[model samples]
Target chain A: MVLNSHQRATIEAAAARIIPADHDPGALEAGVIDYIEQTLATHDGDHAQSYFDGVRELDELARRQFAAEEFSSLGPEQQDRILKLLEEKASPFFSLLVRHTMEGFYGDPRHGGNKDRAGWTMLGFPGPSYPKGYSSPLGWYDGHLPDDFASPKKRSDHEPE
Target chain B: MSRNEAVDVCIIGAGASGLVAAKELSEAGLSVVILERGPWRQRSDFAPEDEISTKRRHFFWPTVEQEPRTWRLNAQSPTEFLSADVQVFSNAMCVGGGTVHYSGLSWRFHESDFRVKSTDGSVAGTSIEDWPISYEDMEPYYEKAEWTIGISGKGWSNPFDPPRRRDYPVPPVARNSAGAILENGCRALGLHPFPTPMAILSRPYDGRPGCVNKGFCSGYGCPVGAKSSALEALLPKALATGRCDIRPLVMAREISVDSGGRAAGVVYIDSAGTEQFQSARLILLAAGGVETPRLLLLSKSSRFPEGVGNSSGLVGKNLMLHAPGPIVIAIFPEAVDGHQGSPCTRVMQDFYKTDSRRGFIRGGFVHPRAHGGDPVDYALQPVHGARWGLKHKDSMRESWRHYLHSHCTGESLPVESNMVDLDPEVKDRFGLPVARITYTSHENDIRLGSFLAKRSREIFEAVKASKVIVPPSRLRKLHNHQMGTCRMGNSPGSSVVDKWCRSHDMPNLFIIDASVFVTSGGLNPALTIEANAFRVCDYIVSEARRGNLG
Candidate 1:
């Protein structure tokens, strides 16, 4: 059950409003739409139709408000306004969209979201320290520094800028 | 179907209890065969700290999509499908069971915990009662489990804690900086804070290396073989004995009986989907609390029509899970760097006993821990003033390094209505009726949870935390520690298992998991389960030697 072009646009635009692109990379830049699209094909496809129906509701709301225009065609301010209305009403559809968008934006990079570890880099998270775990006798407990506490840089730090 | 030669003992589910049982029986010169439903997962399989791979995907256990279970608030409610994300009765499925993925906090239940009903009197609408055995009876076994499993911690710190004959096998792990801060707060509030006894080794013991400070103990398996999981500590020895045969990826379908209505063998399906019957002199069931009872209920026969060992009609009754209190997340002024060491190093057991003044029969233990080791969990777990956008990101970034969260594990009373039974409408991949968990936290549990939250706030305030965030006071599907479905008692009328975890009706059958817990104490039941397994297996070995099993 692949999403249609109009449905994809609505979800992508909706995801942007949920975690809009600021100076930092937001949901759109994090490839959240791609994550959700991939998730719909997995065993958790029972909720896929609900997501499509939810995106349809957003489009219907946009058409009613902006004289028969799709949600993605609307301006950023108008998109934000409609999302705010959904939040106020506590729409289950909007709630589902928000959760999926967050999972995509902040979840693991291997899942086609959190593109290039942008979500982690922006938040200063070291991102899955393994193979080279933190050294023992962690002096942080006693308010003591081991000097050069930041020697082994994060895995993301080695990635090309 | 293929038939295998009969062993001296056949154990279903090679978890903490089953491993101990196999080690004891096999060491006693009895041939033992352990049939595990899950794959033979090893330490190398869990070496990586990938959150998506380990925590999200649940490398230890199969997802609810694979082995589906149903959930309902009460008996009358319409059963609904429980997803892996929200399944309440979450039991691990791999070789080591939950010990492979648990937080490694190995706590012994207090003396009062064994006889809660006797000490505090029974609460209304719950089946809370005294255990058939006392603390003194289990104390020696507790010491044995602690030494064998290699616990590391300070002893006799908490005045209310049950007495132990010897100190821990090793000293407590190095206290993390965040743990030190919480310890100071607890001392200021006049609370007795002690080093938490952990299954993870501080130093090399029992031929295993010490922890590497991986900072992934909460939900991830230890890579360095430091964590004293059953697979690491016991199973290797059992397998080394040359008398134990561990058959992984073999699901125990039903416990077969002889013509004389005695224990005979187990019919299980192999990983290749071929059914095989392995006859044994004695049968031991340790397939967790829910699965243990489900196996019994599924093995219906004409002689025992309601299911084997269910003549009391209480095989799947009296289900209980430790309902954790409102987890209060508090932020400090400076960077705590919580995700650098073990999750729990210090525990405040000031409120681990019954106190009527708090309007609760049993109290909960409050232990502060390093929150958010995984990046994804922190992003989702409600950080204050963060709906979305920059505020959410800023909150997550700041709190990831500075925040500490603590929750009280409130004791849940066993109610007859709160149980696990076969769901008529649902079936697993093997076309077997899926176990339906019917649970609603008792009123006393809710009140105790609220009380624990109030007390936790006082400690946070004492520590001068900048912001204290308390979630809603409701028990969700946090089911890492589940127990008490196939309860133990002296009488056959009120319980499924006897004092030694042997089924009342069946002489050669035994259940050695947390399912035999008469009461769920305010602590992790893994240590107790392991202790009871060692204890019961000792009895089984003696019986096998005497040729009394038949």
Candidate 2:
């Protein structure tokens, strides 16, 4: 359950810019890194564990390129160069960490990732609808919904009138 | 030496088939008891929060304590199977079976589908034979299945669909923006793209409510009774009838027989690892295509050494799964908005025909599907533009508008080499043999894939897509509708089960699922499985009435 402190900070910060918290929540806020770590614990037999190790390896990349404190304190642009090196090595660890973190951000909130469908809803995305259209091209119901599903509050703010 | 319980019928595996079997047998004045190996987890208890259990999704009853059954392409490869960089070969390890976490695209096979050999010549390098029965014989049961457990669809939309006595129980869901775009593209190409039939409830038929359109519908069950999964569809009503005793977490190890050679009882282990025996007059193995064969191969007795009733030695042979991946996902300029409708809203079955020119005996359908491309799947998609800081940001900005994909479920030839044999090394917790899958796609499979890919390109060009990234293989094999292994046939020497789905050697035993299909009918086998089960049960009911338990 224990995470690498500085490694956690780096992933959390990098994931933020990758899928920032501007409109929808970012990776760390949605527990993307935590999910990645937990997924690694059990599925680590696959490339997932290497991904977690890749997190530590990312820190090593930063330290090897720059002094330890200097690399740790470097800004987002500098972090990007280190990531470019990580991606080029095709580091299974870093790719897996990134892969899982993105999964958390986009997967269903039921998996404790999307956080109230914020990631989906923010993109003005509608959820899974039925495909009946039994009669005509028009689906069942006289063709009109009651403003929203039971409650209008849950509907999108910019829903069509 | 555990306490024994007596029952009229003991159904192994609490999957959709087992649930339906329990309902029908119980209603027909027979005592039915279902033994599910996995622990029970009610809908409300399913939490999305826990990372170990939920996010990783290990909370769905059975634990993968032992390594999952592995797969190898061929014998030449190391005994070890390709674990990663390939589709994860998974079987549902939960109470309700795969229905709990399926994409819910339910489809019935076409008429010509049954008579594969008779319609087209025998597929070489494989044993792709016809089923014992035809679609016409099972048509009544298909309608009955639709009515009994409600289905939502616009009937006759699929031109290639077999005749139906009745319309769909419920109407189809509304088309989404993505579907509208695809419809236009298909029509522009002089093709028909009708509404895709789904297993989801559209108009609140039966007791379940209509879909809320929450969108997150794959690898997860509906919290609101929208999806017509077996747990929500049949088991509840069957249990309420009081004729069925459902035993969760009781894994049926083997079917024990008596000196007279009938199924005396089933030996099993419950959740707490306690062994118990349940004797029954009849044993129905609705434990899916893979598990059924594995169980039959594991349940070796003096009466039938090649595993119970497997005298023909076809129990674990000629396995095939509906291949749906290795496809193309193109990004368009305008919005496809794939997130709005049912996972699959429209399909073009125009290409689902047997063409010798394609260098394959059977062909596949071209389908337009709305992918559940939540943020996690974003990077996996091919981007037209470069992928970097600014470019990645630009792609994200265009994502809502630029996603389109097609699925091609083509001919996956059944090969004897692609068999499921018991792993000598790995066994489940209760000391039964685990299935080791060994398969390699034949030249026919590759050729069929190539044909589907060319068709996909033609369709994309007709639609004037800015760019199309067709994978080297036109067909995608990720649908995972695995079939065969213990197929039904006219002769006992050539197949495991007779036309009635009764085991040739063990008269009292029946396996009526995808396992009974001699050749998969170029479509998803869900609806067909239900129909065949009903057909076999009809024969069983008649024979039992004639005082013929044997």
Which structure among the candidates has the greatest lDDT?
1
Tens-place lDDT per residue, model 1, B171-289, is 77766755676677787888877778999898899999987666778777777888899989999999999999999998998998888878889999999999999999889999998
Provide the overall lDDT of each model, using Cα atoms, as 2-decimal numbers.
Answer: 0.80, 0.67
Error of 1 at B276 (Å): 1.8
Q: Once superposed on the true structure, which residue ranges of model 2 sit more than 4 Å away at CA?
A: A13-56, A68-71, A75-78, A107-122, A125-161, B43-67, B81-89, B380-390, B460-466, B473-479
Candidate 2 lDDT over B1-550, as tens digits, reads: 5866687788898877787787777777778888887665677755321222443444442334543465666777655532422332354656677777666767777777888888886756888788778888888888877776677777887677777778888776555544555565667777777776777887688877887544445556566677777777878877887999988877787888889877787888887888889988899998887778888888897677877877888888888875443566666555555554466656667778776675667777766555544445554444435433445545566664456667777767677777887888877777777777787777876776667767776766665556777765422222346788888888999998888888888778888767887777666666677767667777767776787874
Query: Residue A147 lDDT in model 1?
Result: 16
**CAPRI accuracy category, model 1:** acceptable
List TM-scores for all candidates, in order: 0.91, 0.86
Clashing pairs in 1: A141-B177
The residue ranges of model 1 lying beyond 4 angstroms of the native Cα positions read A1-11, A37-58, A85-96, A136-161, B476-478
DockQ of 2: 0.17
